[model samples]
Target: MLDKLSLVVTAPEIVLLVMACVIALVDLGVKSRLRGLTYWLTLGTLAVVAFAAADMAMDGRTFYAFGRMVVSDPMGNWLKCFAAIAMMITLVYGRPYAADREMLRGGEMFTLALFALLGMFVMISASNFLVIYLGLELMTLSSYALVALRRDNEVATEAAMKYFVLGAMASGFLLYGMSMLYGATGSLDIDEVFAAIGSGRINHQVLVFGLVFIVAGLGFKLGAAPFHMWIPDVYHGAPTAITLMIGSAPELAAFAIAIRLLVEGMIPLAIDWQQMLMVLSVASLLVGNLAAIAQSNLKRMLAYSTIAQMGFVVLGLSAGVVNGTTANAQFAYSASMFYIVTYVLTTLGAFGIILLLAREGFESDEIADLAGLNQRSPLYAGIMAVCMFSLAGVPPLVGFYAKLLVLQALVASGQALYIGLAIFAVIASLIGAFYYLRVVKVMYFDSPITATTVSAPADVRAVLSLNGALVLILGILPGGLMALCAEAVVRTLAT
Candidate 1:
């Protein structure tokens, strides 16, 4: 049984769920191609939700709600706040493109996005295995529909089918692992599972077997290598707006769940999981960077780039526990948090530009499409360049600082193996830089395919500018956000 207090802990999710339902009903009357009324209402709902989540995070309190099925804490609240804001920006940048492509004919995109964001909220707050699976399914299902929203397009339909099949397989892996753990531990609550494992009385071999399956499932969700087959196809075949929607904020939720399941629930098995994560990290970097270089399709290239970036995140996670001691846990986990947040920020800007360039009859999704962008619209060109440079780990941008933090975490462990991993990550990053710089060079030096200036809706322009500026500004003064991540992780770990 739940109480009013439990509902209070999930107030933001409640408001979101209610507003999403209302907007869906209200959109039935929306005749505008842009779904203006639905859009504004959705943004308003998200704004309120984000603000409320931030306020709750500032309280720095932790509450176990719904019989410990969910949690409300600084880390979860902050992630919810960021996810909400990211969805709002996605809508702003995507509305025009959706209108151009007739993808907003039913306002389903907006409603589905809200639902997906709500799913992220649930995942961030989950403290039980069932709750986490429920949230993951909710988010992933909405994404599948969104990918298939353009029903007339064979490419989108194919992408949706592929995503559905692979995602289902991955979910099964996760559930099987959870069942194994539950059978061994006699409990599904994360804390209880941790207690059971730490007691040193469980079947170690069974735990290890379950852990292998769990990591594989998580690797698929995070788009890490050896399990990344779905990403490039999905990103390339989906509408650009949906691609951005899929690419950006859900990552924060994934990172949150990873921390909850692995670090919080299974730290006693650190030695085993860390080794698994190390291998994933190495494979992701090598495969992602190498594959991205051969890609001429911008979306597919970015998809592979995403895998490599996730590798850095996994690196940070693998370094959290050293020699069975939790001394560096906070710093290591916080570094991963910082990296994912900044990566999401940079991704939004990069994909925003892609959405802007795509016209009614033109996809504009190839590297060649960006040729001579500077000659037509320097503002957008500069924004795109900033994003490319940031992704390349260029200095004075947020990406450099992000990579630096992860490397610092690795080196802080003072282990030769981690140090070797860090060195390998750097080499992979350097290889990745070549492809990223190639995009910049084409934008600046290649001949123009069109002399017309890029035009965007006023809202999109303003949001895109703000998005790009934040990447640069955050790079220059990253201390504030870095400290915020550290504090959130500290509070989360304390509970």
Candidate 2:
């Protein structure tokens, strides 16, 4: 039996689970005004979990918990740490928006956020299809509730409906894929499945079909082109706080799942899936960049940008090639992971600024709404500029390094055609820059529409400033995080 008492292997999950239950119980017993307590408690839980993950990384163990499930290897530990940090930052950015709108006391949202974190923990460590599905469902269900948290808002209601419908369909696809793989491999364990493929015991047709379905399901989750019809509408309709969570946490989870499925479980089938990802990557880049240029709503623009970023990650993954004896895939996989981290940080920072600028009645979602921001608040404008430039992949910014790594990985893999496509993507990026820069130009160059000062709550302003600074700092010193990402992917591929 799997011992539940191991701290080194289970500390992060156990701490989060215990805190989630405590917060739910305390929320029920406490007064309505005291609901903010749950939020802080949730953040504290994540902090502890993150620290525990870091410690586990230091120890460097791969398998834990009676070897039935759960692993605390560098890969899972690092990804979980990143997910935890992202959750805490999101809570910091979300608190003021919830409070200003009298929505602070929603203990369910806080609890659900913790549950989603738990899902992320399970996702990164999952050794079997059952664990992966369980983790994915836990995260998806919690998100559905979060998106619909503002029950009175019709847009929220509609968006929740769309998310629920599409999310459920995606889950079905994942399940069907799992079933096919199990039939062909005769095992649910990822290691066993990989062994079957490596030994040529698995039927080729079944493996390819199952993989296609799995890719399709994950593509929906990542909001890649041709599967991204729901992103903009949902981003526009969901509350800013909920959008922040969706934009950051879920994207990380999707990336983790992709790494687990493609890099770990299906490495033997690289030639088949890499081509599929390449086509999807190119489509996502073209569609996301072109579509985003027309968006006036800031949240929608970011949603489309998220699609573009996913394309870049896919581009890296698709650069993998099979050699005679071993797969030459490490560079692409590492590049994809690094891009995910950078994209998550940049997107969250941009959305954090949106949450900061939003007032009680005004949402700060529209681009025209940011006109003359510099005159009203130069500090906020400057922070927003950093986010904008970073998103545009400008030099000396983290986003630039991320894109550079991805293109370099593709070129090194001898995929020169993909390199050409990436160059075209750079042009698309410049075209996409016009919209992001339009926001910056309005902030720094335009005249103020009103004389009233744009004031954010103290906590909101602090987080926004820190988030913006971190993006620039990471851009300047990306080597450390990039090295960590390389280590994680190397460890995963080693297995």
Candidate 3:
């Protein structure tokens, strides 16, 4: 049912899919050590797609294609652009690590990441339940393979298995919820579901039950508390490069789908879902920060930290309404979007430093692995410091502004409970800062474990430097990004 006109709305995805296939095929004729050819091609393709996404975002034109199953809008385009760029950075940072470990035997990493980006594109544009689920499956399937790419490693294999089982269960929950929603609303289109529920003629009990399952599934996907059992093991066990890939861009996709399913499809059920998200948020903050304090492994610590950051994102979502006014909807959702984008930006830098520290036969998963990093390379140490401090909500950094916006949105809701959630958020962030600061302390104060120079390839160092610069620059002038997010959210909600 796809046609030429459909391609216009999905041009970036179409181009990316074709290039991924081309890169894979081209890799077959190249020597093993020359895999950099495939890597460069992948990066080139992603750049083109990213530029296309940026163009679409600027256009701010909403166009529905494939019989309204999907739509291109500013919000989706911006997310796709960010996701593509994030994946590009992921690939750039991942290649040397992959090559060092002999995992670059093929173009599997690049192709799979491209396909995952395509999946994210689909998820962002999807306006139908089945389409969003299809995109989600594509992304998750690719990720599962990427995690297990180091097939010879026992830890990677075990992590892949755990990820598969849990991911499948989460998908099942989401699917079941979708089915119940379809039964109650008698439509699979997100807009139709919204209208049907807004009419207040539906079976309230069924809708509420479905909402519970959907929220649970989303929590698992976002690594929220109680459903976050898989993250620590998976992050710790998988290759650091793969962990970085998993951590960065996929989060943008997750945020897009959350907006699609919750804000777009089920706004009429906001009250029920808000309460559900509130519980998940509180639990995630408590579990993630407290548990992270006990972890020595950097990956596991960041994994738990991911859980806590997701709580803040969801907290913003939960505060979108107070007393059913819907007046704060735009500001609230935009704050969540800003938080997710900035969080992913900082995550890339954090994980990039980890990748930089990795060498042959050595995985830098331990907190102590960063000892004397500042003395070894102040440039990288400063980069890592920026990321860690940003995550800790330190002032004059992007993460601080992100957290501040969320808290402001919550407080502006003027509900005692929501205000209390803001206080809880502040307290949790304070408690969480210890681990983040501890990483910085190790980098700065701890004596060197190994005196080897922290060296990386030219491209890696250059791009990483730019990445770190963007984090600080954005923090210093967060207005442009905040405005973009606000505009995108407002445009999407208006349509």
Candidate 4:
């Protein structure tokens, strides 16, 4: 029922979708030698979308379009902009790696990635539960194909199958929850459901029952513990280029959906979801850190670390409402937004380095593969060290500030349990720091596994350096971005 005017809010998504289709068609006429056209076209599409999102966010436009099924707001727009830019950077860092591994035999990677980005756009802006699920499926399906792009690789195929099965189960869980909520409230629209709950007196047992399933589904998507069995195998078995594509940008979308579903739609039931989130957070922190310590593979270790880092993000979410007050909701969620954004930024740099170092017949996935990196390429070694330190929550890095703000939100709650959780988070972080430092030590102290000179495309090197500098710069002066996040959360939540 959406006409052009009614759907204006989805302009960025429309452009990207059209671009993806056009690129797919054009790819057929181009030869392999000219496949770089597909890459360039994809980059142009991303640039246009990201620019549009940024401009919209800067203008502070908020729109509810297509009969209120979707929204255009600063928070959604900024997240979309970040996702597009992340995809652009991922493509730049990944092209050479994909080419080396023959994963670029066609233009599927570019088109599929574009489609995945489209999915993220929808997920970010969706105001309907059905829309969110549609977007999630689109993204996950594209990711499945991307992971198995190396169709001949048995491991890649195996990982793809596992991802598909697990993703299906998670989707089922989410859909079932939605059905339960619909049965209770008789609405699929998030706002309508919120209003339905608000009109009621107290707790709805049926809603609470649905909440558990929804949290389980969200936990799987976020890669939190007990539901995180897919992350390590997928990250390890997929091509590193594919891993970068799957890991970095989708996280921002995941965070956006969490805000939409939990904060926007179900704040009335925070007491219930918060308890579940706390358990997931603690489990993720303990399992992610402990499991990571045992992994020799860099990608797998990062997978586990992702679980732990996402735990911090979840921890921030858990602190949003305290003592039946929404007073701290904005701050807690804003802190989580800042944390995920910075974490994604840091992750882009870390994984970009791994892709650059990878050569044909060598995955460069093992931690020992990075030995003597400083001797070979001090620039890269330094970049990797910065990322490792940031992930470990070392001071004067953005990650530390992210954790500090989240912990501050918890402390401000004056809740003994939250305060204890904060202390536990610190201790877990301390335990996790050892593995991160080990990577740095290997880069600095250990001898090379091979004496090959490390090199990357000029653009990859330039973007990576900028990414590192941004993390450090943001850490030094976290005001602008922090303020931006707080403002976005305040405005969106107020609406």
C-alpha RMSD of each candidate structure in angstroms: 0.7, 1.7, 0.9, 1.2
The TM-score values for the models, in the order shown, are 0.99, 0.96, 0.99, 0.98
Which ranking of candidates, highest TM-score first?
Answer: 1, 3, 4, 2
Model 1 misplaced stretches (Cα beyond 4 Å):
none
Report the C-alpha lDDT of model 3 over 1-495, residue by residue, as the tens digit.
788768899899889889989999999987866397898889899999999999999998788899989899999999999999999999888888888898888778888999988888888889999999999999999999999999999999999999999999999999999999999999999999999999999999999999888988888888889899999999999999899888888888888888899989998889999999999999999999999999999999999999999999999999876787889998899999999999999999999999988863589889999999999899999999999999999989999999999999999998899899999999999999999999999999999898888888899999999989988999999999999999999999899
Worst 10 residues of 4 by lDDT: 1-10
- Which residue ranges in model 2 land beyond 4 Å of their true spot? 4-7, 32-34, 64-67, 322-328
User: Model 4: per-residue lDDT, tens digit, 1-495?
Assistant: 687755578899889889999999999987874377898899999999999999988878678888899988899999999999999999999988888888888899999999999999999999999999999999999999999999999999999999999999998988898888888988999999999988885349999999889999999999999899999999999999999999999999999999999999999899989999999999999999999999999999999999999999999999998999988898899999999999999999999889888953588999999999999999889989999999999999998999999999999899999999999999999999999999999999999887788877787889989988888898889999999999888878878
Clashing residue pairs, candidate 2? none
Q: Count clashing residue pairs in model 3.
A: 0
Point out where model 4 deviates above 4 Å: 3-5, 201-203
Model 3 Cα displacement at 284 (Å)? 0.9
State the displacement of the C-alpha of residue 432, model 2, in Å, after optimal TM-score superposition: 1.9
TM-score of 4: 0.98
- Show pairs that collide, candidate 4: none
Give RMSD (Å) of candidate 1 vs. truth. 0.7
